[model samples]
Target: MFDLDRWIEIFQTLSKNKLRTVLSGFTIAFAILLFTLLFGIGNGLKHTFEEQFKGDAQNSIYIRSGRTTKPYKGLQSGRRIQFRNEDSKFMNDKFSEKIQFFSPNIERFNVQAIYKGEQNSYTVRGVYPDYQALEEAVMEQGRFLSVLDIKNKAKVVAIGRLVEKDLYGQLSALGKNITLGGISYKVIGVFSDPGGDNDERFIYTPFTTAQGIYKPNDEVDRYGLTFNPSLSVDQALSFSNLLTKLLKEKHNVDPRDQRAIRVQNYAEGTKNVEQFMGVLNIIILFIGIGTLVAGIIGISNIMVYIVKERTKELGIRKALGATPKSIIGMIMMESIFVTALAGYAGLLLGVFTLNALGDSLEKYFILNPSVETYVVVGATIILIIAGTVAGYIPAKRAARIKPIVALNDE
Candidate 1:
């Protein structure tokens, strides 16, 4: 099967038509290059979308109160809806199995934080221990708020990395006091957020402490919940809808009023994004395969031309006792070699391009864009099959050449 002499003959034939061979090879190479680049870019887009979901739990849902848009149950429209600690407790008690984590968020705007005579204005929030996981906060030092802190209304603060740096400036803030709204609270922890520096400008305290200090009564700004991982997106959405309905009923808001109880289903958002990416991948594949089909057609046409030009030589070989199978094998081998070599060049170029831009692209949320090894192997197989098929009809024509007829052709 390994015929060195036959390979040498095939190379000689290809070398004789240098321009034609180069053009044919270029077509195949360009097609593969386009396919690789499009696929890599599609993957990059997917990575960018995924990075946006990193700041929160994938299945998390947020519930916030808004002004009523329609009157219901004798209540007038335009009534501002508000949530309290009782509502959070009721939801936690009622949906214990369905919920993974729940936190009632209480926000105070433009709060002054003073530490060692250095003061800066930042938004302050009161949250529970579960808010740590819900917000995907990474503790850089000390510990986050605990259940005991909330129960006892402890005057302890967990500051963000930005807040710590602004107020303390490289010095350890733990066990140190910070005056928030004129109330002295000991620093307990410092945290970093996936959402970058903007998210690190807020400080967190125990919900009870915030309620006591801010005197917003029992009112909370919003509620955050993450569903159990075992639930599907549809299932989680159904649960969110049920919760919304229950809240509307409990708060005496209109059942059909959408604005009274606003719920953000992160699971649904993520699912929609994934569906969009699926469509994007399909579009990329369609265009890539279309380019490859054109290249294959070009290879087929060139092989036919090669056969036509070498009809007399093929006939001479037949007359000299060469078998039809050997002639077909020679033609097919040439087609395969040209395609494989060009494909390798395209693959190498695509990989090198991705590697060169990987670092720069990461700043835009695109991680390493690469084709898997198995996909590359599969593409190589496809190239070989395509090369053989492209040459098949031409090789058969060469095999059927009659020595007498071919010798007479000018």
Candidate 2:
């Protein structure tokens, strides 16, 4: 199967025709390179979209209250709506099955947290044990807030990893006392969040402890909960809508009031994200298909031109008693070889470029741009096949032509 003389002849021809070789190689290489880069950038965009939405649980919903914007049931438009422990109980009693991991929050910003001589301003939240899941916090050093801690109003806190680092330096914050607003709480845990730095800088304390210390009575600032994961996006939206409507009615707000009670549903935003991602996928697929088609066409035309330019040479071979099969085989082999080399070169170059880029494109939201190895290899094979087919047609035509006519052409 290994024909040494044929290979030598092929190499000799390629080396002698430098322009032809470079033209063919460049066509295949550029096509493959373009396709790889475009696909990598598209995937980078997809990664950016995913990262943007990873700040909270995918099924999360937040309920917050503001002053009523419209009068209803004799209530004035300027009435300030509020969430309370009674509202939390009402939600649990009414929508127990629809809700998952509910938490009533009492949040305070610019809280001065002091540990020994170190002090910093941070956001502190009083939350239920289930708040860990709501915030998607993972316990790194110890345990999160327990139900017993909430019931007993324990002076214990779960500090974020960044909070611990900022105050405790390299020393562990676990079991240490941190004073917030002159009230000292023992650090029972340290947590990390995928939600990034801002989330990481928060301090979580037992709901009852913070509530008793900060609130006038049983007041809650806001509520956060995740819906049942089994629910479809439409079902989740419906659940949130019903919950919003009921909350509005319970508060005596107008049905059309926009600011009295508001629900922020992650699922609603995810629906738009899904739609955009679908359109994006279609666009990427279209671009890839279009690029492959253009590459095939370009290589096919170039192969045909190469054959035309060598018509006299082919005629000379025919006169020397070379068979039609040998003629087609030689041309096809050269075209395939060139295409294979160029394609591989493109693949390596594309991968190297992506690696060299690293996270430098993060500002542009193009993180870790790359293409799968199999994908690039398959694309290269396709080009090689296209080159063979392109060379076959013209080679067959050249072989059929009378040797005298080909040699006589000016």
TM for candidate 1 is 0.86
Candidate 2 segments whose C-alpha is farther than 4 A from its true place: 352-368, 402-410
lDDT of 2 by residue, 159-270 (tens): 9999999999999999999999999899999999999999999999998999999996899999999999989999999999999999998988898998889899999989
Q: Summing lDDT over every window of 10 consecutive residues in candidate 1, give the lowest-scoring window.
A: 372-381
Worst 10 residues of 2 by lDDT: 367-376
lDDT of 1 by residue, 161-209 (tens): 9998998998988889999888899999999999788889889999888
Give the number of the best model, judged by lDDT: 2
RMSD of candidate 1 to the truth, in angstroms, is 3.3
lDDT of each: 0.86, 0.92
